[model samples]
Target: MLSKIQNTFILIVDDTPKNIQLLGTVLKNVGYKIIVASNGIQALGILEKIKPDLILLDVMMPDLDGYETCKRIKESEKLKNIPVIFLTAKTQPEDIVKGFDLGAVDYIVKPFNSSELLARVKTHLELKFNQELLQTLLNFQRDMVLMTDGEKVIAANYSFLKFANCKNVEDFNLKYDHIMDLLEFEVKVEKNDVSKLLRLPKEEEFKVKMKRDNGEYLIFRIKQNVIPEKEVSILSLVDITQLENQKSSLEEKASIDELTKVYNRTKFQQLFKNILEENQVNPKSLCLVIFDIDHFKKINDTYGHNKGDDVLVNIASFIKSQIRMSDILCRWGGEEFTLLLVGSNIEDGVKICEKIRVQVQNHPFIQDRQVTVSMGITHYLPNDNLETFVARADNALYLAKRTGRNRTERN
Candidate 1:
């Protein structure tokens, strides 16, 4: 039993009315809607008015021949993707090749077999429909698309437009010069270089700063790849700024001194291990200094625990401001504080310790009256664990307190 086909729009562009009638009859019988154009020029005029799913063009015409007409249609951004099949009398190799060069997907000879023509058109129509569907899916999918040749954006989806805070696709009409430009982006791409598209390898991901017009910056991950047998490239963009922010918050809260707003012993222990491991691999001199407020109990007794807490907060702030960026400052419970100076050797660490001790003595932090601290500074031995490292610094701190307060001792 023969089945009826659904209506498909097909444009028949041929100068001869008889050929159009024959082609029209075959397609119309199969439930296709036919639009006729007597010549290539007429076909183009009709094209501007109506969009066809497929076109059948006779190569021979008085003017505006099939090749020229097909070229113009293929160049159009909207019409270029539509499939064009040539109707040709010339079966010569060069003629066939020329039709293909002009973007004809297939050719139908003059005095075409009805079944053969229908079968080929049916195949091409199915394929064109699938391609169009795929393109639609890519344009509207939740993930953002960043298409490029290597240097500039060819196209991007709605999600990319929303995230980029761009007025429209025109904003990114030519942004990005290289894959790395999109890498770990700290800012939006203002300029695009198209030549970089020729250089990107497959499956490489880089972090980039993506900036929007509204001064919002997001850290995005970019995945670059070339589509097989295709002229354009496809890039997938994902916003990762939230993940990085979460990581920062978690790190900050993980080992924070709750009362003093300083680094706690937990952070010190973790950082010390990592620093030591790094030093072993890259080799850097470091020193640890431990200290405690002198007569802390007496201060608590006289000024109440609230004043004692205030003293710790004030002292912690003071210690933090004095240290270099490479140094780690932490409150080590009770009245004790520890310093992990990354680049400082034993002598330099002691000099820093002495400075802190003298600063404490001269400053005389007064919640009610003067307060002072005895400090101990020591360098970590090779492969020393946290317990042993603390013991050595604690011993030095004990010595400083033994020989009066407000003094620094290093061992």
Candidate 2:
């Protein structure tokens, strides 16, 4: 979210110290770095040296009046776009109109409100910030903005290597066509639509996927615009893989038991939603395993609570190590842990739970010297809902507890 901002500087021009001091204090507080000029001539000298982002010019002044200073500023080609606002004692509508006719963006009559002054400054600052941001995005890394000619990439920004997943920019210098046919894009890609974009030369974003050199599919938001003075289309592609991964990671964190770092009850419900959404197309076999450490409360009583926490961490780590990356593991409160295996059926899911239980029972705690686990496992039914899936797993977990501790049960 960090961005570049041009015109971060503000110049305050006034003959009176009182007015300058008041405006200078307010603008600086709101994060606009300030430059002060005591008179109109002093302001012109500073303007010649450094073109400020915005200038607050006072109408009444000795030597050159505000009108002459503003007229001189307008006459210069380089300083024309740099906005000028009038600060004046004259509240007459005609005076305000004259200030505009001389090329002022807005005017403040006499005393300015802290909120109103800040509001105007903040708005312009943000506008400049966005423009600078667009500039940065265009030429970031090898992710260059390119203007293409028909089927081939004609030219690109500094960020050229990323789109094609190439190692170096030299590979992109050559013309490339049949890119859409080669990349295996899920959605239709139209190079012709880029011509329609020429009418309005603003960035337009559309969702697209890129096939990496390693055959990995990466999500991207592609932005296209027409380049001024050049008969070409500008293309900017931003990778969104990190955003998607972060969203999944946060969702997992939200449902986890903090102390044990395992999925809590909240994660169980969310996992169901994820499975069902994907189940509409893919033949995903959903599996859940619930495990609780044996005699955990008594262990807390024998050792200090710290030791009991250590025992839980050990068990969770043991279970976590045996699982595949496609599985979800979370602390389901207290000494309990839950695993959601993405594609494992009942038999495979049961085997996974048994392996974890035996691993916990056989491995002595490096600290406590003794600890064990009992587990219950279940597979998702074709018609199973959230409560039903979990209830079946819980039943098996209870059955494991009934048939002596430190064992696994599945149905």
Q: Find the candidate with the highest TM-score and give its number.
A: 1
lDDT of each: 0.80, 0.74
- For model 2, give the 10-residue run with minimal summed lDDT: 175-184
Clashing pairs in 2: 142-159, 142-160, 143-159, 144-157, 144-159, 144-160, 262-330, 262-331, 263-330, 263-331
lDDT comparing candidate 2 with the true structure: 0.74
Q: Model 1, range 1-411, lDDT digits (tens) per residue? A: 021246578999999999999999999998889999999899999999999889999999989999899999987877877899999999999999988998889999999999999999988888887765655776777777767666556666778767765544545553433434544343333344333433356426666676666767777787777764565678787777899899989989888998888889899888888877666422236777888998999988988999889889999998888888888999988998998888888888888888887787677677446678788888867667888888999999999999987888987
In terms of lDDT, the poorest run of 10 residues in model 1 is: 186-195
Evaluate model 1: give its TM-score.
Answer: 0.76
lDDT of 2 by residue, 99-211 (tens): 99998878887788989887776666566556556546656644546556434565455555555655333355442443343233345546565355432455366666766
